[model samples]
Structures are given as C-alpha cells and as structure tokens.
Target: MIEAQGLTKKYGDRTAVDGISFTVHPGRVTGFLGPNGAGKSTTMRMLLGLDRPTAGSVMVNGRSYADFPAPLREVGALLEARALHPGRSARDHLRWMAASNGIPVRRVDEVLDLVGLPDVAGQRVGGFSLGMGQRLGIAVALLGDPPVVVLDEPVNGLDPEGIRWVRTLTRTLAAEGRTVFLSSHLMSEMALTADHLVVIGRGRVLADCSMPDFIAEHAASYVRLRSPQQAEVAALLRRNGLEVTDVDGELHIQGRDAASVGELVGRQGLLLHELTLVRSSLEDAFMTLTAASVEYSARQQTPAGALR
Candidate 1:
C-alpha cells in the first residue's frame, strides 16, 4: 500500500501541494484526479522521491522509495514527462534498466512481448509514433513485475484497442494483489476503471471515497415528467416533500426515484407522456466540483437564439 501523510510542497512564493493525506490500498485501482495546475504532478513527484518535499513524507509499502535496493522490483511508475535516449532501441532500453537494478536480462524480452512490442523491439524509439512510445514506457514500468504501479495518463495517444488493453491490464494487476495508482483526464474511462477516487483542487484534497459515493454526492440526479396534467403532477410531488420545478411544460422532480414518482402520479390519475431519470455523469460532476478551483476560466458563448 502507498501512504501519504501531510504531504506538502512549496516553490518560492507559490505553494504547490498542501497538507494533503491519503492512502492507496492494495488489490484495487485508485484513481487520482484534479484540474490542471492543481499540484497533482508535484504530489506524484514527491511520492516517487523525484523531488524533495518541503514538508511531510510519502511511503510505498511502509518504506520510502529510495530505501529499496532494487527499486524497479518493488515499485513501478510511468510519469507524464518521459526521459529517454531517443536513438536507443526499445529492447535495449529495457535491458539497460534491467541491468542497473540487477534485474534479469531475459526479463527484457518478456516485458517487450507483454506490452505488444515484440515485433518492433529492435526499432529505435526516435522514429516511433506517440502511441508506440507510450507502450514502450509501460513496458519499462512492468519490466520488474513490481507490486506497486503508478501510471499517469497511461492511455494517452493510444487507440481504442490500446485503451481497452490498458484498462484490462490495470484491472488484472489489481486482481493480482498489486497496488495500482492511476491518474487520467478521461472521466468516462476512469469511471469504468477505478474502484476508488482521490480528487484534488487547488493543491488540497477535495474528496477521497469509493467511486459510487463520489458520484452520488457530487453529481445531481432528477426525474423528468412530461404530462398533460403537469401542474397537478408537480403539485402532487411537492406535497410529498419532493422538490419540483416546472420547465417548458414539464415537471422536474428531486428527492424521489422515477419509479416512486410514477407510482404516486398514477395513483393521482395523472396521464403521463414521459417519465425519465437523468443523472449527471462523472465529467459533469467533476466540472461542477472544480469550477471555483480552476485557475483559468473561459465564459462559454452560445450561438444567438440557441436558448429559448
């Protein structure tokens, strides 16, 4: 498990990461989310010991990252910024890493094949495409079969198939009892992948909870009803202690499920044309939660006559 306690980082007059604390447990995929410039990168850097923190500390498996003699064999990570000798072949790169950490040379080919780059293992990465580069990076991370994996935007530049492959791979890793910490900007994919979430805004932890709980708390849900007797139906819902709003000859109801609302309206002899539940998606909830924390904001301009 990865444990961070009072993790903080400051740069001159700017404070990047505040006193944030969270735990990433084993046997599950924990997603890290935040708006741009929210100190996510800095926090991750501190976790990996790439940057010295101004205060507090982070530990992987109850030890600092540098304490492991064979670091790759204990913890694997793929950060957004990659440092590579572009002229080196993909296979050779992994071999060099494996050699430095006392990893077996034969493991190079295994990782190459695992990442779907066996056919082009000898090709220099300088000429590779963006997606290919990402695969090679992942191969480097998994070269040692570490127990902890930290991936930042692992699906970046990947095609649909590659994306699916990453999703499956992360889930498989977690199932194998490894700790997987994933950070991605793709909300739809994150929703499908991560079992837990750690959301940050302005260098502070906004939320840390299970996937379903985060959405249920931050995202709004309402039942929409269209009927000839909209007024009566709206009044009925209001009388039942439900919040009802009238819009465009339709009733929007809160505090009740569609099924219960339909049953109530039916008992009142109200003829219904439509009844549907609308729940905001992860992306929607994220936007609403981080609206004020955004450093840069743009006012959306709609086309003239776009709204009635």
Candidate 2:
C-alpha cells in the first residue's frame, strides 16, 4: 500500500504541491486525476524520492522509497515512457534495468512476453513506434514484479487494443493484491479501470473517494420524462415547483429522482412513453468540479471587432 500524509512540494517561490494526504490501498486500482499543471507529476516525483517534499511524508509500504534496500522490489513506477536509451534494444533495456536492481536476467524475457513485446525485443528502441515504446516502458516497470505500481499516462500513445490490454493488466495486478496507482487524463478509461479516485486541483486535494461516490456527489442526476401529453406534464411539473427543462419535446426534471417524477406524473394521469433517470458522467462531474481550478481557459472573442 502507498500512504501519503501532508505531502507538499515547492519550487523556489512557487508551491507545486500543497499539503495533501491520500492512501492507495492494496487490491484495487486508485486513479489519480487532475487537470494539466495540477502538481500530479511533482507529487509522483516526491513519492519516488526523485524530488524532496517541502513538508509531510510518503511511503510505499511503511517505509520511504529511499529506505528500501531494493526499491524496485517494493515499488515499480513508470513516469516517462521515453526515459530510455534509444540505441538499445527492448530486451537489452530491460536487461540493464534488472541488472541495476539485482533482478534476474530471465525476468527480462518474462516481462517482454508479458507486455506483448517479445516479437520486437531484439529491435532497437529508436525504431519502435509510440505504442511499442510504451509497452517497453511497462515491461521495465514490471521487471521486479513489485507489489506496488505507479503509472502516469500509461496509454498516452496506445491504440485501442493496447489501451484495452493496459486496462486488463492493471485490473489483474490489483486483483492479485498489488497496489495500483494510475494517473490519466482519459476519463472514459478511468471510469472503467479505477475503483477509487483521488482528484487534485491546483495542488490541493479536491476529492478522495470511491468512483460511484465521487460521481454521485459532484455530478447532477436528473429524471427524463417523455409523454404524449408533453405540454400538460411539463405544466404540471412546473406548477409543483420542480425545475423542468423541455428539450426536443421531452421534459427533463431536476432535483428529484425517477420514482418521485413517476409518481407525480401518475397522479396527474399523464400518459407517459418513457421515464428514465440519467446520471451525469464522470467527465461531466470532472468539468463541474475543476472549472475554477483550471489554470488556463480559452475565451471566445468577437470576430474582427464587428460587433459592439
């Protein structure tokens, strides 16, 4: 398990990571989510002992990363996919990594096969495509078979098949009781891959909760009602003090659940064709929560100053 308590980082005058605390427990995939420039990379660096935290502490398994005699055996991290020698073959790269970490050379071939890179193991990494490079990076991370895994944007250059493979692999690792901490900007993939989430915004902990709880708390849930008596139903709903919106002849009722809406419509004797509850998606919740935390936002301008 990974535990971070009051972790903070500073770069000269700027504070990149504020005092934040979150726990990544074993047997599940915990997604690390934030917009660009939200101090995610900085926190990861501190966790790996690559950067010193200005305050607080982080531990992989009851110990700091530097305290481990064999760090690779404790935690495997993939912060950069291209942080390898371009002239080296995929097999040679893993071989060197294993040698540095005192891992067996045979483990190199095992990781190659595990990442579906055995076919390209002998080829120079410079000749590999983006997806191939990502796979090689994952192979290095898995060389030690550590109980903890931390990956950042593992599917950045992957195709659909590669993405699916990564999703399954992370889930399998978590099922094996390993602590899997992943950071990604892909909300759709996170929704499928992560059981819990730790959302940070502007270097502060915005939320830390289970996936379902996060969505329920941040995203709006509404009941969509479609009726042959659309006008009557809408009027009745409005008269009842419920917030209703008409879109394409369907009445969308907010601030109430599907059961309440159905009961209200039934009491009015309105003929209903469809009544469904639509929960806001992860992306919707993310946007709503991080709107103020976004560092950069593009604003629309009047074209050529023609409008007053």
Candidate 3:
C-alpha cells in the first residue's frame, strides 16, 4: 500500500500540490485524475521521491521509497515513456534495471514478454514508435516484479490494440494483488480501467471514492420532455421548482425523475411528444468537477441568433 500524508509541494511562489492526503491500496487500480497543470504529475513525482515535498511525505509499504530494503522490488513506476536511454535496445534497458536490483537476467526477458515486446526487444529504443516505447517503459516497470506499480498516462500514444493490451495488463496486475496507481486525463478510459479514483482540482482533493460511487455522486441525471406546448410545459416544470433548459424544442428538466415529470405533465393535461431520461456521462462529470480549476477552458459557444 501507498499512503500520502499531507503531501505538499511548492515551487517558488506557486504551490503545485496542496496538502492532499490519500491512500492507494493493493488489489485494485486507483486512478489519479485532474485537469492539466492540476498538480497530478507533481504529486506523482513526490510519491516516487523524485522531488522533495515542501511539507509531509509519501510512504510505500510503510516506508519512504528510498528507505525500502529493495526500492525497485517494492515500487516500480513509469512516470514518462521516453525516460530510458534512446541509444539502448529495449532488452538491454531492462537488463540493466534487473542488474541494479540484483534480479536474474532472464527476468528481463520475462518482463519483455509480459509487455508483448519480445519481437522488438533487440531493437534500439530510439527507433521504437510511441506505442512501442510505452510498452517498453511498462516492461521496465514490471522487470522488478514490484508489489506497487505507478504509471502516468500509460495509454498516451497507443493504437486501439495497444490500448486494449494495456487495459488487460493493468487489470491482470491488480488482480494479482499489486497496487496499481495510474494517472490519466481520459475519463472514458478511466471509467473502464479504474476501480477507485482520486480526483484533484487546484492541487486539492475533490473526491476519493469508488468508481461507481463517484459517478452516482457527481454525475447528474435529468429527464427530457418535449410537447407541442413546449414553452408552457417548460414553465410548468420550472414552476415545480425544477431547473429547465430548452434544447431544440425539448425541455431538459433537472433535479426531477421521469415518473415525477410524467405525473406533472399528466396533471397539466399536456400532450407530450417525447420524454426521455438522460444521464450525464463520466466525462461530463469530470469536466464539471474540474471546470473552475481547468488551466484552459475552451471558448464558450454562442447561442443561436446571437450577434456574429
């Protein structure tokens, strides 16, 4: 297990990571998520002991990474894909890492095969494609057969096949009782990959919960109703103390259920053309949660008939 107690990092006048504390447990994939520049990478760096925290500390298996008896055997990480020497072959790279940890040279071949890079093991890493490089990086991480694994944007440049491979590989590792803490900005991917989530905004914890609970809490649900008397139906729904938005002649009602909406329309004797419930997606929930802390918000779309 990895525990971060009030881990805080400040660079000059700017605070990169606030006093955020969370635990990453074994046997599950915990996703570290936030918008770009939201201190995700900084926090991961502090967790790996690459950067000194201005306050607090992170412990891997009840000790700081450097304090662990065999750090590589206990904790393995892939902070960046191209971190390896460009001139070295993928096989040679893992071999050196194995040597550092006093691991058998055959263990290097096992990890290369584990990451499905056996054929390209002899090729220089500089000539590897982005997806191949990511695979090679993962191979290095698994070379030590660490109990705790941390990966940052492991699917950054993979094709669909490569992405699926990573998804299966991560799940398999977690299933074997390893601590998998992964970082990614892809909400859809996280929805599929993560069992738990640690969400951050402005270097602070926004949420730490199970994936299902996070969706149930943060993702909104609404009912869409359309009627010939659109404006009247909207006003009626609004009068019931529900928020309504007009979308293409449909009334999108918030904070109300479908059965309640149906009853309301029935009581009003309104002839409805359509009424459907829509659930906000995980992506939408993530965006809504991090919007204010988003370093770059996209340009707002103007309503129809606005001044051009």
Candidate 4:
C-alpha cells in the first residue's frame, strides 16, 4: 500500500502541489487522474523520492522510498520511459539495473521475456521505436520483481495489441497481491482497467473512491425513449412529474430508470418504438467534475460551411 499525508511541493513563488492526502491500497489498480499542469507529475515525483516535498510525506508500505537498500525491489516505477541511455542495448540496460540492486543476472532475461523484448534484447535503445522503448522500460521496472508498481502512462505510444498486453499485465500484477498505482490520460482505458481512482485538480486530491462510486456520483443518467405517439408520451411523462427533454424526435427523461419508464408507458397503453437507459461516460463525468480545475481552456470557432 502507498499513503500520502499532506503532501506538498513548491517552486519559488509557485505552489505546484498543495496539501494532498490519499491512500493506494493493495490487491487492486488505483488510477491517478488530472488535467495537464494539475501537478500530477510533481506528486508522482514526490512519491518516488525524485523530488523532495515541501511538507508532509509519501510512503510505500510503511517507509519512505529512499529508506530501502534496494528501492527497486520494494517499489518498481516507470516514471519516464525515455529517460535512458539511448546507446545501450535493452539487455545491457536491464543487466545494469539488476547489478545495481544485487539482483541475479538471469533476472534480466526473465524481465526481457516478460515484457516481450527478448527477440530484440540485443538492440540498442536508441534505435527502438516508441512502443519498443516503452516495453524496454517496463522490463526494467519488473527486473527486480517488486511488490509495488507505479506506472504513469504505461500505454502511451502502444498499439492496440500492446495496449491490451499492458492492461492484462497490470491486472495480473494486482491479482498476485501487489499494489498497482497507475496514471493515464486515456479515460476509456482507465475506466476498463482501474478498480479505484485518485483524481487531483490544482494539486489537491479531488476524489479518492471506488470506480462505481465515482461514476455514479459525478455522471448523469437518464432514460431515452422514442414513440410513435410522441406528443402523448411526452405529456404523460411530464404529468407523471418526470423531467423530460425533447431533442429532435427523442425524449430524454429523468427521475426513473429505463425499466420503470417502460412500465409506466406500458400501463398507459403508449406505443413505444425505443426505450433505453443512457448514462454519461467516464470521460463525461471527469469533464464535469474537473471543468473548473482544468488548467487551460480554448474558445472553439465554427468553420465556414460547417454543418449545424
């Protein structure tokens, strides 16, 4: 498990990270989310002991990251995949990392195979593609067989197959009782992968909760219906004290789920063509919750001859 209490960071007059506290438990994947310049990078740096916090502390298990004799064995991290010696072979890089922490030399090949880099293990990292570089970095992280893994944008630059591999790998790690802390900008992928969430805005922890709770609390849900008798259906629903919005030819309703709405319409003998429940996606909910916290906003202009 990882815990941060009143974690803070500062740069001259700028406060990059405010006092933030949260816990990342084991046996599940906890996703870190924030918009650009929300201080996510700084917070992660503090967690890994790459930067000193102006106040408070962040600890893996029960000790600071720097306190471990073999830090990689305690906390395997992939903060910056490209921060490596470009001229070194992938196998050489892993070998050096293994040697630094007294890890067995054979572990290098194990991690190389685990990250699907054994075929290109002898290739220089400078010539590796972005995706291959990411894989090599993952191999370095797993070389020590750490109990806790922290990955930021692990799927960045990965193709569909590579992305799926990462998803499965993270799940497998967590299932083995390791604490997995992941950060990614892809909301769709995060929704599918994360069991819990730790959302930040302006350096403060905005939310730390389960996936279902976060979505249910921040997202909107409504019943959508299309009927041959549109006018009667709208009137009936309105008279029944439900909020209804008509767009084009469809009626969007609140205050009831699809089944309840369907039952109500059926009891009134209304002929319905379509009825379904529409819930806002995780992206939608994130946008709604972090609207004000977004570090940048742009004014959109319609192009000439654009469709309405």
For every candidate in turn, the CA RMSD to the true structure comes to 2.3, 2.3, 2.8, 1.6
User: Between 1 and 3, whose TM-score is larger?
Assistant: 1
Q: In candidate 4, what are the lDDT values of residues 217-257, reduced to their tens digit?
A: 99988889999999999999999999999988899999999
C-alpha lDDT (0 to 100) for residue 188 of candidate 4 = 96
Please name the candidate that would achieve the greatest TM-score relative to the true structure: 4
Instruction: Summarize candidate 1's per-residue lDDT along 16-108 as a digit string, tens digits.
Output: 999999999999999999999998889889988899999999999999998999999999999952568889999899999999899999999
Lowest summed lDDT across 10 adjacent residues in model 4 is found at 299-308
Question: TM-score of every model?
Answer: 0.93, 0.93, 0.89, 0.97
Q: Write the per-residue lDDT of candidate 3 for residues 86-149, one digit (tens) a residue.
A: 8999989888888888888999889888888999899999999998999888887887889999
Superposed by TM-score, candidate 3 places the C-alpha of residue 159 at a distance from the truth, in angstroms, of: 0.8
* lDDT, residue 181, candidate 4: 95
lDDT of 4 at 22: 95
Q: Which residue runs does candidate 1 get wrong by more than 4 Å?
A: 247-250, 302-308
Off by over 4 Å in 2: 266-269, 300-308
**Cα error, candidate 3, residue 255 (Å):** 3.7
Could you tell me the TM-score of candidate 1? 0.93
* Higher-lDDT candidate of 1 and 4: 4
